[model samples]
Target: MQAWDDIINIAMIGTDKKQPDTISVPASLAEITTRIITGSEKNREEQFLQLASLLYNYQRCGISPLKKETAGTAAPVEEKKYCSTHAALALRDVLQDDNHSLLQYWLERCDSRTQIAPARFVPALLINGERNKKLRLLISSCVGKRGEWLSGFNTAWDFSAKQTQEEIWQTGSLEERQEVLQQTLVTDPLKAREWIRQTWQQEDAATKLVLLSILAPFADESDIDFLEGLSKEKSKKLQLFALESLRTIPGSPIVLMYESFLRSAVTIQKETSMLGFSKKNTLQCKLPDAVSEDLYKTGIDKLSSDKTWTDDEYVVFQVMQYVPPSFWEKTFQLSAEALLELFEKTDTGKKLLPALTKAAANFRDRNWANVIAQRRSVFQKELLPLLPLAPRDSYINHFFAKNINDVMDYAKETDEPWSMEMTRLILREAAKKPYPYVGFFQKVIAQIPVAVSTELSSYPVSEDQYSRSLWSGMSEEISRTLAIKNQINNAFTI
Candidate 1:
């Protein structure tokens, strides 16, 4: 028989160039090969095709692959804590669909209770972790031993890799350095501070501010000298960073400096109103009885030209922001609640409320945030992040009856999941008012877990065709979205 290599050789040049296969025949194929090689039974190309067909038939029936040595090693089975089915399904559903809001919820649950997600979910989590920096820690925690093993294959997902923290600090990009610095501060604040101190003068203004901002967590009187030195810098941004860091450590010299400056200009005053017995006396925020030429230049002096408020009122608002919110409680001889309430009664309180709430949000005082929510219809948006995550699933549980869009905006800003009660509230309101965008409502609904929204499955019932048509269409969208989610739930671990 002709060798297979000889057949390949004739095929390479094509029948047009040379007809080696047609010119010669193997001993075994001498009879049929003679017909194609010498006979006019088929032309050169046709003859080549017939030869190829015979080989194909022979190989399928005759050829057999030899048993060979084993291939590359399988990935080691990681022994790790497996998440519950509910948790696993929840993670998969949110992750696969790009439901960031719910993914945030899932990550939070994993973080709070040390829940490890399924191995299958790790790869996707790693991919997503590269997309959003904030989720890196939570994703790392959920990734388990197997996921860590997988991260080495992709540089983007290497957040969990252990390296010389100093290397990252010295050579990493600004974002990379900040991430390393944040972790360093958590583990060893002194080392973090030293790193900043070494690079302080060498770094540019933007980098310097970035480094200074992360110092707040571990800031103390020890950091005061460095910050004070920064205060002397010509860059206003640099000086602002120094002042902000100083405010974190209440007893720091910088805060004390501001405190001393304000001690004389601000004081508590009680006023008596003789109009009615019910309105006898209440405290008022009082400024200096007399103003001197020195007062106007310092923030201690009233300084705004706008008629909306007095110069003294404007100055007090500015001073309240810098000083600790606690200072007012002691200065006014009122508790935080009473002080905030007393301020609410005055027009000056309305102007100053934002500043005081800012201090509260910065200091992470929940009491201050709550009291603001109590008295005012609106609270500072920044305060929500200072609140804990994965709050028993229903903490921000109800949507206010009015201001549906505002409530939704607040929910998104906080990155917290809306409770089913809240979702139901939104749907019920939509059924009544018919929210303008069906697609937006559909997307938001998809993020909510099927389990949580079980009771809200059926909604917006109506007899009128227009109203009925709208509700029915929205219901169908929810149905289709949840049906796919249900399929995923069945297909997934939890």
Candidate 2:
């Protein structure tokens, strides 16, 4: 090792700067090194290269095999039957194409029938599951005993392995620990909190941030004290994250303070019509000339990033983002529709409506989402997920003709199977603009239900030559994917 280190130093200094005669080799390799350098009439650089090559080979060849423990016992007999050959072939195609949605559908169907993945595909499934957390549980269900057995050898797949949750929490990698934290949070949040509390001091800042995020969705009144303590952390990002988590808890001190501030800063006033028969509610925002110390401590920024809006407008925007949209409804004593109507008519609406839309999304307020979706100027595609199935489909149906690209964006967000009516609508529209949007269609092929395969078959051919070529190719791909999906479904049934 010392000889190799000397050779490395000589190499780093270069032959011109340090003579090749300075090179050293292990006792066993010394003879070969001398032979390589002695009779060679080569210059110092060539001699150095030769000696370096010899030492590198000697070091590599001398490496001792790592002393690992005994090979584990053979995998146990699988309780579940392997999937049918056709189903395995379908899985192979999905994997080969790297089509995640279809892969999920395949795993779901296989698990529904209580069949394990083919032995050959278990490793690939486990590897994919390692990268995609959403697929891990599904993969665990369908990969069955062999996959589970294989997981024991690769710690990366420990989520599917038979290790106890406590064991994984203590010894697993960061990802595995986070997964365990999430599962424990769902089953026993108190225990999860205790674990984080015990390890809080030992974790680095980044790890603490991740652990805090894992607690966000499951955060409750019990977590308020812990989160409030973290809100005072020196790390700005960690402190901000803790504050954000507290905002999600309804009665947390931060939320109560935010509510108290907003209660005075924003108010609704009633206005009478000229005839004095009808009344309208107007949103009146009165931000402080300066952001108070208390408000600033709650993480409200003092300046507006948007050049068009003043600092005060931006401050109000940040406040609205944290408070649930329902707060506006309760405070104003108006329906979501009426409150939206008020926000839209005011000069302040420009800044507040976006924040309101964001709050609707953040708080998962369906009523506010629906009302906001009705305003064409303010609606965002991000709101699609908040709408229930019937309303979402209706929204898409209403807007699909003018906003084909938007519908494509929504398809990318979700893996839910399309209804027959929506399927027909999308297919008909996609055929009309097959050049670009058809490519988007190819990605979402799994979302098209199998029942629509018949419609794909009966689809009319285009009259134009160019359009015909594109549709023909698109139609064949759709048909083939549907046929494979059908085969996968039938294989599981049998």
Candidate 3:
């Protein structure tokens, strides 16, 4: 195994030197060059010249050496011919069967450019996985220059340039540098965060805003300090965006952060209502006008019989929903019943109460389930009767229908009204499923009472019933059973 591994590793490196993996190279130089040229927008001429010059210098004898020549004389014909000859030789040496030679040559040129002696550094920050301080310093130089160099690469360079670009981000401008920082942070989050901190104050407000925006992509608990600082901004927009960013760091101490802010600036009060709920200790905080408006628009309608809300309000309420139940213990101790009553009175009791209960349940609060159950009971009792019966079982409404199903789960505790309703649905569904005991369905059919069989005469019939006698000889019991089965089958088919 060891010998095989050694052979495989050796095959990976261009030299017989053992390495890790095979490189995935772009198919052609024209493709890579086209990507570089078309993808870049900044310093186009300079970048182009820089790339061409680097390629030229790295090519075998491609560059004409500056050597002693007769002053004011163009008599170095031999040298020019030799330079072309060597360039062709170098091209052959570098390009022949080399998959990643383009990147290798680029790195060699970069190393030569930064050399102080025979010893020189290359763009090995990503390649060698080294923490050499010079590599970080070089990255800083790129960032400080506003990431002007990054535009020259495209998706085709993702493999070769990915690491070097990321390392350079440690030095890249805070706002301009986020593009590079994005790739590295996923693999080395702690170091990426530290890099952000080292340059935090040096970045301007706009740059800070851009840097914070990326927090949602790769935020962790360690980012709380940076977020807290940004959240305290005097600008409302910045404060909102910062708060929004903190939301991405799930299970973090964001609520404590939010609570502190609310305590300083906002208050919530409860209003009396006919629904038997009135309490002053409501959870309240004022977001920016837009967020507040969004919450209001998304909250369940106060007058809708459905008692359901849209998805956006739930997202706005998610911060409270994710808070550990223990955090609410103090409130529970003060007046658990009062809090419960307030939840019932809230406009979105059906939606908010259940979520609030579940979140509290995580802390072993027994009342969480009890409170949600109580609200659920009122909802089932009051609203179940008004739900429309779909002519067919719809896939889209399956979940909502399921919720109602749970509320009215068969054989559970129920009054006559509910029992009667379920019996009707069961008969209707049973008929569709071809259940044999169609005669046993008298309870539901009797309640329907309109004599659907006789009523068929008053409705439109086939122009010639004699010829359309599809069920002419069937007994009443068999005919009724077949009709019910057909209807139920049709319902599900739709």
Candidate 4:
């Protein structure tokens, strides 16, 4: 230890200015550090290497007491079977990069089979969790109790939220406690809400909003009282969140409040265009010159006329936002499918699609969700969370088939592995698309499962100008990703 400390002191000043003198060492290590420490006195890099070798000697010789309590045998191994050595390697590759959706492929497999991640994976996973917040739950499931216990010792790995729920909740940092709440919300939303209420007064405005936002999906009548109280707050964000919370709960008072507004403000009065012309019957939205105090009090932001939407159009949107999409079915006298078509046709439907999309996602409206999801022209990855956890890759697959960006977007949304068909298409697209596609493919290639690499290479690209120019920059990136994947496969081959 003394010799190790001496090397460290000299290294701190660096060899550029300071060099280690001949130092005595243990009779055994004297020969070892002499050889290691002798020749590399030229520069700081050399001194650093010499010092590291000496420290390794100290570490090798220094063993803490065996009697010191072992991390009481790993938390009971999960009943789930351990994945095959091969699957674990695939997972290691997935976790090595930001492939949350691909990682889900492993997580869901373990979940479906009641399997656990091999214990060897916990250290790397713990590091992965530090950088990507999304990985923690999946990591927790795979690592089970063993990873939870292991994470606390390494500062880099310590953020794993699988253990010490109470200890972390009470004493961990704000982010830590928030993670506990998210996990708890999944298992016990009421409990999470009560916990939020217990500490509600202490959290800052941002934290309070986040806490409230957590209640979005599972929120019920049980949440209404607290959320309604928040809706009355002065801050617009707090008020909006409260309104959103209320909106998620079907037929909550806030929903009814908006429903009543729509009842009074909207009508289907039929009228003929000019005399003896075809009827101009349609959904008509009316707004009073002034809204009731109660309506304003309930956190409805009054609309100022805009060029795109009349005051009536804007008010109708706010009203529909709180009203459940199902309510629109009755109000408009149209089925969910019909309503989606209507949104495509009418000026008002276009205005209302954004509001309806939020409702469709939040209220878990299956029919509207399907229609809106299919109709969505661009990626709405956020909705993936609100939808069912089961594989929706078939739906995402349609989008991925159409655009390269879609390939990038949906892969991050769920844990489902790419279908063989999707893999073929991506390979074909990558082979033909020009240089700009190179940048996106390079990052995403690491995410492609190793199982696909053999097939990926088998694809035959035409020697056309576009394809040639495309693969020039792109193939190298793809090759790099595949090489790393091979390394992971080889390293973990047991």
RMSD of each: 10.2, 6.2, 27.0, 7.8
Query: lDDT of each model, Cα atoms only?
Result: 0.65, 0.78, 0.41, 0.66
Q: Could you give candidate 2's per-residue lDDT for residues 360-414 as a string of tens digits?
A: 7767678878877766545567678778776777777777778777777777767
In candidate 1, what are the lDDT values of residues 1-494, reduced to their tens digit?
A: 35455568768977787664533444666677666667686788787778777665665676676542332335456555677777676666676667554465567666666667887788888888888776776677777776676766667878755446798788766877898899888898889888998887789988887777777756777888888787678899888677777666677764565566566655545555666445422334456666454434333445677889777677766666666778777666678878777666667676777878887766667766666655553455555555444331223432254445665666544434455655666666666555464666545553455754454446655566787777667666666566555554453333
Q: What lDDT does candidate 3 reach at residue 319?
A: 41
lDDT of 4 at 299: 56
| Residue runs of model 1 more than 4 Å from their true location after superposition | 1-204, 207-223, 232-235, 245-249, 257-263, 267-302, 344-354, 383-409, 415-452, 455-494
Best by lDDT: 2
TM-scores for the candidates: 0.59, 0.70, 0.28, 0.62
lDDT of 4 by residue, 1-494 (tens): 66667667766886677655446466766676566556644554675576577667677877775542655665655656787777777776766665554455456556555667788887777776777665565666677667767765666666654546767667766666777888898887767777888988888788877777766766888878888888567678988878767776886876787787777776655578777668744556678666677777765667756788887778777767666788878877878877677565656666767877776666777666666666663344445544443334445556665555755566544334455555566677767665545566544543566666566556676678777866755665566566665654453344
Which 10 successive residues of model 3 have the least lDDT summed? 115-124
Q: Of the candidates numbered 2 and 3, which has the greater TM-score value?
A: 2
lDDT of 3: 0.41
Give the C-alpha miss distance for residue 230 in model 4, angstroms: 2.3
Q: What lDDT tens digits, residue by residue, belong to model 3 across residues 113-152?
A: 3421111111222222123222333332222111212212
Q: Residue 15 in model 1: shift from native, Å? A: 34
Candidate 3: the clashing residue pairs are 140-171, 143-172, 143-173, 431-484, 432-488
Model 1 residue 398 lDDT?
A: 29
